[model samples]
Target chain A: MSDLRLEEINSIHFDVLKEIANIGAGNATTALSKLLDAKVDMHVPNIEFMEFKDLAEAIGGAENVVVGILLTLDTGIDGMMMFILESDSAEKIVNSLMGRTCGSLDEFSEMDLSALQEIGNIIAGSYLSAISTFTNMTITSSVPYLSIDMAGAILSVPAIEFGKISDKALMIESEFGDKDTIINGYFILIPTLEAFELIFSSLGLM
Target chain B: MGTVIKVGMADLNVCKAPDALTTLGLGSCVGICLWDSVAKIAGMAHVMLPDSTQIRNNDNIAKFADTGIKETLDRVLKLGAQKSRLVAKIAGGAQMFAFGSNNDMLRVGDRNVAASKEMLKKLGIRLVAEDTGLNFGRTIVFYPENGNLVITAVGKPSKTI
Candidate 1:
């Protein structure tokens, strides 16, 4: 077997991430459509691999973000994807789900948090599952962790962990819907070094 | 002279004698260390989450609060140090997330600190000091040579634990 190197492995990992996100976006669109009772068009705009710091900056335009991670049993086989949305967009998603035009924090119910977690769970899990299928790997995901906070704290995470694993990271930006309820998502894919090697070797692409 | 082994989230750094171990910018996370002043041996860990409940068979044992702390303690003991001589000092548990003033669920940082203290007590370890809670990031330095815990917070001077 040839030497297992990062450059050889990362390309394959990036491709798998893109294809999975492409398929998963369809799942997200369908779920949102059903939830909102309207057609929500979701598009995966860009898929690029960059450093964790760069991915953080790209998602910085938003005020509020929904961050989630989907980890598999395989140590290196985890994927993390976060949704960055302006606070207004997040409020809109909640309002639309609650069937209200505007609602205060007191008016907001636990149902709203559940609704947001459900959306994040579906999108993050679907993306990881789709990627696992393409890679011919069996992976399981934990219930997604949902947090809504300022962009800074959300962005600071990858810098500590993900950046140490890969020189550059895989990312996809998706835009969905056309109504006042436009939803945009930034999907990131960062595989550990061992997982990166396994994908390429398994695909016979190394 | 103490050697400082700086650790980060989900990471652990170990050092022996004349060494001071440390972890910085700990917020909503826990920093743990087991040090033997007489033996001048120590181990430090910075864990982001509370438990292994989120994952299974996660060999990265340093990513959780109780497991990481216990692992560090074991290592410090293995370095020719007796368990009775081991002492613990912890810092960091800042509420980094800004939420509604009434939102209790946002107290992840506070929860982490409380959980760590309780776990240590259960383990029969003496916590000589702790600088936790509040809303500021912390830089922790563990001096193994003298069992000195130097804790420095943002906008605050360094103080011994």
Candidate 2:
């Protein structure tokens, strides 16, 4: 990982990042499953080098209105962490939390929205804790902010925040959910170039 | 047989009248659509940052407000857009979330909008319409023939400016 640019990373480096994501997102799903009392399953994670434009299409498309929970990282690794879900999945998770049927995706009341944020907080908390414990780094996440909008818009914050140092983003995408397969959501982890260097070096993978 | 030209992130493109230009999922980024009514020329740029001067090795002209708008203007001008007749309609510079930590990086959306406006003013192009600054994302489809920009969002009605 020494002298490795995030934009043009090699296969081995991607594997290292992928492994970190596996453990981190793996814990995320466990936390989420416990909260919903649903047996959550996680799909294999993907690490890709993408431009800002392709990021929106990765989840669905730019026009696909989805729910996202974002947490800004600052303790050690600087970047953004996001949890995204389709409208239906978001409604399902919120409904389960409220102990009632959330009629439809578009019918979220203020209480439902807040519950979604709490869901985001819990899942992201576990994800960050896993990364910190594994790497022995002081990584911290900010309060969760929820947004339900175009995927492109939700991803823009990270693109600009890390744009000056890297043109393309090194992102890890992981999908997780329950047996009904109704809770399909993406746990997107975007770390800065410096953060990647630190992670790789700290883990002796570099 | 009309074309809907797609403009990628940190990229810009120009099209003639009866053709439209579009960019998707603009969170903290700005999508500047410039129209030359008489020539029926339209150009759109998806800029990711405010100023290129802050960083060295600023190779991509379409990634910053200052350089992106300049390059977009140049392309439209070459495509028969008269400098004096060009007017701008902008969209997509919304703060997607609020952060208690006022890190300058988190506030890039507000700065991006300000930079776009400054560049528009500097280029002496009139900003006829704008849809910007909210906690939401927008996808902009710009029609050159009528200078109408269609702004779309999730869970919200589409609007034409």
Candidate 3:
């Protein structure tokens, strides 16, 4: 298999990435719906090769406060996956899970944080499992690390990882939310350059 | 009131008295602010990595702490800032997420902060103040007129150094 650069990624490659994102996010959305016991809607996944500076703009702005759950792909792929939600959305999810009306995100207790982390773990597991099954790759993820910070700060982890190799990063982003409360959560997947080549060759696209 | 000039990630810029330099959402990346109070000139660089020499694609000088600080200093000097009167204040370099594993990539924040201070010392610039190496991200604005570096973080009080 030939090495693939971010700049050299063509429409066909994007289509495959999108399909992977679709399968992964579709499973995640289903898992979310089951957990929440409510119908959830997911937007078509967007695969974009973005500069490090523009990564934060995907969720609104750099300084926008967000709750981020990050996990490293330990096997089969060398990269990371992130589940990001706006502060209010995270609060809403925690409230829904615990069946309590937690007025604000600022007042999240330790239990609330743990609940959020568990939600992240479940959703991320479902997403990865779907991708692993579809591509026949044994993908395993590290324990989720949770953080509440600015979108820019949270995204910097993956951006720095990508920056080591290139100025731009290729991300597969999917947005899923509840219909009533409109709790929008973003799922971002960033595979390393070598992982991209492996994925393409696994599917005989290279 | 000065206009806020935004410095993007892995980027640098210089401005005068009435214009301030700002960079948003610095996580594991350091924002270096260099000022010549007498000249009322300021420069800011948002560096992503610790060293440029260690990487093969080192063309983007503004992407590393060592090179980024030097380039920012050069730009400010060209804008009439005196090198002898230059002082530096830095913010950002946060470990946004904590993990048990001892991966070097996760320690980029500390490395960036250390590299930045080393570069400032090598350039003969006095390191006056800093807010770094915490588990939170920071957004910083640098004003040359007063040499104040204002740092703001989520769920934390904003401070000026």
Name the regions of candidate 1 deviating beyond 4 angstroms: A1-13, A61-76, A79-85, A104-108, B1-161
Error of 1 at A198 (Å): 3.0
Candidate 3 clashing pairs? Answer: none
Best by DockQ: 3
Model 3 segments beyond 4 Å from truth? Answer: none
Candidate 1 structure quality by residue, lDDT tens digits, A1-206: 22454455455555765666788777777777888888788766688766533454576621223333322233336444455554555567778877888874334467876776677666666666666666788766545545454343454343333433444566678888876668767665555556666666566655
Query: Model 3 over residues A64-104: C-alpha lDDT tens digits?
Result: 99999989899998888888888888888888888887557
Worst 10 residues of 3 chain A by lDDT: A171-180
Which 10-residue window in model 2 chain B sums to the lowest lDDT? B98-107
What range of 10 consecutive residues in model 1 chain B has the weakest lDDT sum?
Answer: B96-105
Summed backbone clashes in each candidate are 5, 0, 0
Docking verdict class for candidate 1? incorrect
The list of candidate 2 runs beyond 4 A from truth reads: A1-4
Every candidate's lDDT = 0.63, 0.83, 0.86
Model 3, position A194, has a per-residue lDDT of: 85
lDDT of 3 by residue, B23-126 (tens): 99999899999999889999999999989998867889999999999999999999999999999998988998887767666788888999999999999999
**For each candidate, what TM-score against the reference?**
0.54, 0.93, 0.95
